[model samples]
Target: MHSYGQFCGLAKGLDVIGDRWTLLIVRELLIRGPCRYTDLCTGLPGIPTNLLADRLRDMEREGLVRREMTPAPTPAAVYALTPRGEALETVIAALGRWAAPLLANPHKDDVFLPHWLVLPARLYLIDRSPRQAPVRVEVRDGDHRVTLEAARGRVSARVGPAEKPDTVIIGQTPIAWQLLLGKIDLAQARKAGLEIQGKTTALKRFGVRPPTKAVFISP
Candidate 1:
């Protein structure tokens, strides 16, 4: 609850989200939208359970989030951003843009890539397929959305469950970064016996074509 003098908007805003963990928590919610406590903990590595609980409580008290009961008999609740909290999305996006180049390097430690990619993946539709109708993939330790249904050759990307996908992407490292960094070409990776399986046409739809003018972090 530290406060800056009344006149400084930036300082006052930081008063609510300036704590070590608060902005990180806010970033997750902003990127992933509503999430359960478990999701938060899973997505954020190294945060202790007790500290997370305390931060959530403080966020709730500060009106940055609203906790709503789910339909489960055990009375589970999900935390979602309040209007005030949602307003931070722009700030978060700016931070991501600023940090992008610092993360693009392949030789750097990959620990932060997952968190870094989450927001931009959502923003840029990096996992989405425009050429196919239903392309579903499940990251072993990632969030679950819904299954996708596509014809043999159409572009789409769905998260969550599927019988099997043409190409199953698996990594804790930023998939987007891996694609962009030239560490591995999708075709080359597949040719070298990566875990790809299914129609080649379907797989082709997941190609990475990052914008030519974008800045990225160097190793």
Candidate 2:
């Protein structure tokens, strides 16, 4: 709720969302859709409970979020973004793309969730073969798994096993990223503890290719 007392658009926007953990809250809602308070806590690692409650209250007042009561056997309250808040998708996507290189070397203690790869996967995996059948790539890292699908010149990701995967990539998260982003070829990724099965062409269809000037290569 802090403001710079300015009338500019960017400044005005910041007045609402520039607070710590604010946009990340938006991120959770964006990725997870309507969810309960407990769901938010799971996605957000270190946010204090009181701070989350306060932020939710402030966001509600500002018309960025709304709470809904579910009906029936599993009746419960859920939180979802208002249309106004949903409009921040472009801003979040742009920010994520701008900050992608910072993911090159994660700290050892940094927490990671498979669902988080959804955003970056959509950003990077441009389908090169729209005419072909959809390609489903199941990525397994440690105990987590996510499925990335490419069809009609776009890609989408979700956390869980794919119904009928065209390809399966098994590796630690870092190695998996390197493979997906074309930082390493399949052979190199295999040497680095990565494994692949099923259709290798699926990777190519998902835009995994040799590093080139046109591609955003991580440092």
- Per-residue lDDT tens digits for candidate 2, residues 1-219, read 789999899999899999999999999898878889998999999999999999999999999999999899899999999999999989998897677657656566778766677767766668888988889999987777889998887888877789889999987766677677776899898998888989987888767422322222222
**What would the per-residue lDDT of candidate 1 be over residues 51-115, giving only the tens digit for each residue?**
99988888899999989987867777789999988988788867766665664455654345244
Model 1 residue 157 CA deviation in Å: 7.9
How many residue pairs collide in each prediction? Answer: 9, 0
lDDT of each: 0.60, 0.82
| RMSD per model, one decimal | 5.2, 3.2
lDDT of 2 at 191: 95
What residue runs in model 2 are displaced by over 4 Å at the alpha carbon?
A: 208-219
lDDT of 1 at 40: 90
Model 1 C-alpha lDDT versus the unseen true structure: 0.60
